[model samples]
Target: MESTEWHLTSFVNLAVLTFLFLCSQGQVNGDCPADGRTWVPFGQSCYYFVHGNEDRFKSYTIEKAKEMCKDYGLLTVRSAEENSFIVENSLQVWKGGNNNMWLGMYYNSDDDEFKWNDESHVTFKNWEEGDAEDPEMPLIDTCVILHAASGKWENVSCSEQPQHGVVCETPQIRLQRKNASPLLSALVVISVIMILGISAAVWFLQQRKGSGSTLFPSFEYHPPFRAPSADQTCLVEAEEIDETS
Candidate 1:
């Protein structure tokens, strides 16, 4: 029973070490960047909502929003789920102004279709019913915006009035731990545990027996001269006398 407990403890230690290693690699912690923007993580992407609470945040045009976004593109709503996520983050908590916000999608007059600025294929959409569907059609400069009040999308000129605050989008980035290392350390730990287990077993067995007793008491060695049996004695004076007679 004690031996079983020792193995269980070893495995538990291994799992804890593995979890810590993964956390250090950002595989477990999910630590996002702190760029003074409110970033919400969903699926594999991260969305930034403009709440105007940060000193760096302000209202900007679509192009300017793209510029301020750094490596992140403008907000792109792909699915109703994603659209709802954006709405929950942006419109529900919007404090910027009455104007609408920009999306990564734009009307491409050449293809006569709306497409994402990031060039990801449009697999889903959450267009507001009725007039919101038409951006006056075939206009190359037409762009999409999130309607502030209704929490839906709207069509407008890329540089039109009612410009909005910047809501950037970027893949989540995690900080690398400078002191993190690999699994070789775990192997060393296992070696130490094994040595400890062997020592513990030896101690347990020694305690079960009395003091001055070896682990295998039957195999204890002693000098032949110290033996009490005549057969084991080194000197035999009676046998020597009989041989001379």
Candidate 2:
């Protein structure tokens, strides 16, 4: 019985220790942000290709496109790699006539320079040669387009040109809700394990008690049956002998 109790206690203790060890080594989920609709991650930012509706196959002007991207983020671009990322993804979308998409850049006649909608410096330009300048209509073509065939930028009149697609860019930060702390999760698991262990211990003790095999058996005092005294025995024998005679 003692050995059985010792084994059970050892098992429970080992379970508890194992639970604690695993809890201490618990890990949280990865920190990568969740991907959004049509959004792809490249480097430290996310890019989305806003596809046109099926029926109309519509496109947006530069101003309208910026307004569309307003809820999520600004129409933006920075690097050649970023531009390429957008172009490649946008190519996957079903294209209509020109297959051109609006870029966030425009010609600034006042400054005689090209600038992004965010007013960032244009370090990278993928413009096709002889594009962005028209001898016939010099300053009219202010907006830029990513030509579908060549994946190069072309200057076009924003209003005169029919609507096209737009690319939306935002930083690759966690889009999902923050996870609970690893320590807190571990503690919760540990608590569950402890509760189960305690419940098991209680069940085992109850089983032992039900089977009349408790840790401490109750003791009752009862004097042993006493033999007859020598004088009593002798008198009984004499009486028996006299009666027989």
Candidate 3:
């Protein structure tokens, strides 16, 4: 019937709307960047793809670039994960000093090794040819980043300050109470309970005091809590004699 058809149509529409709402609430997996910006959840990084070299800002030194990111609770770029995130966003932002943007990894001259500031191994690498060839490079040092235009990796001097594209080291969240141990958690719980208990006690006392009426009341004190000695002794003695008789 026509009525049955209308009811089914309404049910289908309701189901579709509910499905859409739930889909939007959860994160999308393997999805491209949303809007003009790509959200790199893995690195907690957001990259904005800019076409050509038009609107790029003046390059900053590694330290200065780091400060800028830090101002926004972000850090200078570093690491392959971050590099991939930037490329995915397709932005030509400056890294390092003048031309190179700062990446997360840096070269350790003392150890003569390419090490991630995050302590992760550089198992994967994508370097450009004729790259990692800084004349002043240390024998045992190598930082990694994408080529300015090609988004390829190259080794550069860690000490050399550049005014180009640079990556930031994402700030790591340190569980300050990491070593707090179970005793610390217990102490915190006990302290909270004590505070709540004290507050409750104060509230109870205030309520009790408010409910009791002592205002405008008169007080008469009697020693030993007995009435005046008018004839108490005589009455007691007479009563005793009568009892004996």
Candidate 4:
């Protein structure tokens, strides 16, 4: 019965630990700024579209678009889902105008590789057949743009080209609600209290157990030896003399 109870207690503690861990994870999240810009949430990051002319779909060169998103870096599509999302938003934002937009990727003819403007590694990619089939273009033809009709990337010359909007991606951010601090603090304190209380109760119960196992090590106690005082010694000698007489 004791063993069963102990196992049950262990299970309860494990469950509580798991719950608190999950709560902590949920408390911290990927959130963009509360600024006026409409930041669309994509896996672990936020995105904003900047065409500069919201009244009408206007296009900007790579340099101009970069300037427009000067506060934030140019869009770097890391995955297919992110690429698709950007294309969809561009179609909505640009409407009648050409939906082609500038990306952060640029061909590095020296390294014979493509690189993002922010220097992030190129892991996942979605490129059109023309881009992959064609031999590497010259360094001047390094810039990349997302084809609106099809969600694929295309290499284009960095020279004067048709106007295209730019997208901005913010740095990694963690979200915490202004009013949620006190609630989270209370939960943490309560969790700690519960764990300590359970531990103390378990200790007390173990100590109270009348088992052969001792709570503390046992040891023998011996009284210290002492020499007789002068009066006691004299009395002992007198008694001995009377006995001898």
Instruction: Report the C-alpha lDDT of model 1 over 73-98, residue by residue, as the tens digit.
Output: 88877777877676666644564345
By lDDT, the better pick of 2 and 4 is 4
lDDT by residue for model 4 over 99-202, one digit each (tens)?
77788887766767788877667888888876843566565476888877788888777874656767888765876634446677678768767876777677
Scored by TM-score, the top model is 4
Best of the two (3, 4) by lDDT: 4
TM-score (all chains, Cα) for each model: 0.58, 0.51, 0.38, 0.64
Residue-level lDDT of model 3, residues 10-114, one tens digit each, is 556655754564444443333323444323444444433222255454556556655654523222344566655666443424322224455656666666555
Which tens-of-lDDT digit does each residue in 144-169 have in candidate 2? 77876677877777667567777676
lDDT of 3: 0.51
| TM-score of decoy 2 | 0.51
TM-score, candidate number 4:
0.64
Best by lDDT: 4
Better of 1 and 2 by TM-score: 1
Clash-forming residue pairs, model 4: none
In candidate 3, stretches whose alpha carbon ends up further than 4 angstroms from where it belongs are 1-55, 71-85, 92-99, 109-111, 130-136, 139-144, 158-160, 167-245
Go through the candidates in order and give each one's C-alpha lDDT: 0.67, 0.69, 0.51, 0.75
- Counting clashing residue pairs in each candidate, in order, gives 0, 2, 44, 0
In model 2, how many backbone clashes occur?
2
